[model samples]
Target: MNDDRATSTRSETPEAILHGGDLHAVSGRYPDAPQPWIDLSTGINAVPYPVPEIPPSAWQRLPAKSEERILLTAAAARYRVASRDTIVAAPGTQALLQSLPRLRPRSTVAVLAPTYEEHALCWRRCGHQVHLVDDADALAHADIAVVVNPNNPTGRLLPRDVLVRLAAAQRRRDGLLIVDEAFVDLYPANASLAADLPPATIVLRSFGKVYGLAGVRLGFAISSADIATRLRGELGPWAVSGPALAVGTAALADDAWLAQTGARLARDGQRIEALLENAGCAVIGITPLFRLIASPIAAGIADRLACHGIHVRRFPAQPTWLRFGLPSHEGDWERLAQALGSSS
Candidate 1:
């Protein structure tokens, strides 16, 4: 891997920050590509959780307080959060991300660099002085610190102990530590800080990524009761839809399905890594959801794949890097392999 080409400071404008799953935009760019494009752009699970049937009432009426409670209870258990009261359910983690900055006064925010772009973007947009720092030790100087474990696009997983110490440092100054555990579901016991949360820390868990149900729009924030309550107040009544509540509740309780999916994703991760390596790409990041690779012709490779109707993630800042999510079906695997062979 070319470290010089891969290392870039967080200097992208909000408009320049691109995310995956934008088929419409990609289609516009590659108008003559194939029909039914194979989207391996986002880190989202290619195979989503089987959604349960929604009751008629869930569609007809507003979500009841009882329903919300039940969803939170299930999420609390699924995330190993000690108290339901400490978890605040929302439409999605994106909503919580936007709302979090508003809850506090404008202050210095330090984000572990080259992780998710949204954390720094949100804080900066909310009038905070945002610094994109290179290490956890640098984060200690800021009023709020954000860390994305098993980080997006790179698959960097910070150990629980490292995060605990960072949180402790933030606590000493009454600062907050926000840990985004969006991809930690695959190895929760090894990486998640949800079970034993540190003081002045807030952990955001994404239901859509691991569950493969991004459309359901269910996510939770685990923190102190006071912080949770404040977030709940910010998100008014029925912040999450009725169908989302039902689906989240049912999915979180299905431990068997979760285990099976995790195992499958693990196998798929290895399969993709091997495939990339054979294509002469150096795999740098490995998570159950996606793989990041480095190649001198990464941009050309992405375009070639796009022409074949296979969309992988390309970073503007890191031109040598490309990130690919797992192919959902056997046909997708074949298509990707063919595309990679042709691109090389």
Candidate 2:
């Protein structure tokens, strides 16, 4: 079966969201399978961090500069970033991603292929020349190099030293390096490039993925102080809501929650790998929050899962591959196992 997929801006049409998490459309197709759908399409933590109570004033007033400061400060501390001047907060990583093309003039951009398609999509839509490279080592020739560390779908993480060298080389030629570390925090100490950020390097981190608060709509862009200043101005003031700022601050500062949740995700990821393998699916790339598997009948398997009111991500680029997120509960896990057992 043809497995090509696409993403949308909220899936205005029923057929728009081909990428993942389109339960609204799934429900229409499988009305008889189940009541609630078990969506394992994205790498978001299934057991999300417990959201703390927000002050009523947070909802009553506009997000002040002081409130933003608290959120950024908390993010810096949590991420172990040394310089606050180099970090710029936004409504979400997606907002910064699309705006990045606007900040620079049309130029040649080399995106590591088969990662997150949105990187290339946003650049191409903004009139930039985009070239798809095979790996991080292929960044040598591009004017702007985009690396999705712990890459989406494949979970192929580029080495820190290699990234540092690439950034230095790119900067020498007046070029730039953009790293999407959206899924890097699960292995933060070993995987993150935030601590020793090089000049001309722009790193994007997500508050929603690890914290399981995608709706909170908060993220950060890390770069040189000048670039951060420029992005801050371009994004304008009050880019994030007061409720988002308050909630993000509490979530970022919860050390106990972070540690406990991280451990739980790691443990759960292993269970998923074993389960998938036992079901005859080859567990290929295992990330802390998700797993990418290979099945001869991946498209059919995904369709079968949908019939059971379970949704998984399928990639046409690699016809045999499917991505699955952690199932949140015992019933959901049992449902998934039964679905897999019955998969074509």
Prediction RMSDs, each to the true structure: 5.3, 5.3
lDDT, residue 244, candidate 2:
93
Show where candidate 1 strays beyond 4 Å: 1-12, 342-344
What lDDT does the true structure give each of the candidates? 0.89, 0.84
Give per-model TM-scores. Answer: 0.95, 0.93
Question: Which 10 residues in a row give candidate 2 its minimum summed lDDT?
Answer: 1-10
Residue 15 displacement (Å), model 2: 13
Instruction: Give lDDT tens digits, candidate 2, residues 220-310.
Output: 9998888999899989988999889988999889999888988888888877877788788998887888999998988888888888989
Off by over 4 Å in 2: 1-17, 342-344
lDDT of 1 by residue, 61-96 (tens): 999999999999999899888789999999999999
For residue 56, give model 1's deviation from the true position in Å: 1.1
lDDT of 1: 0.89
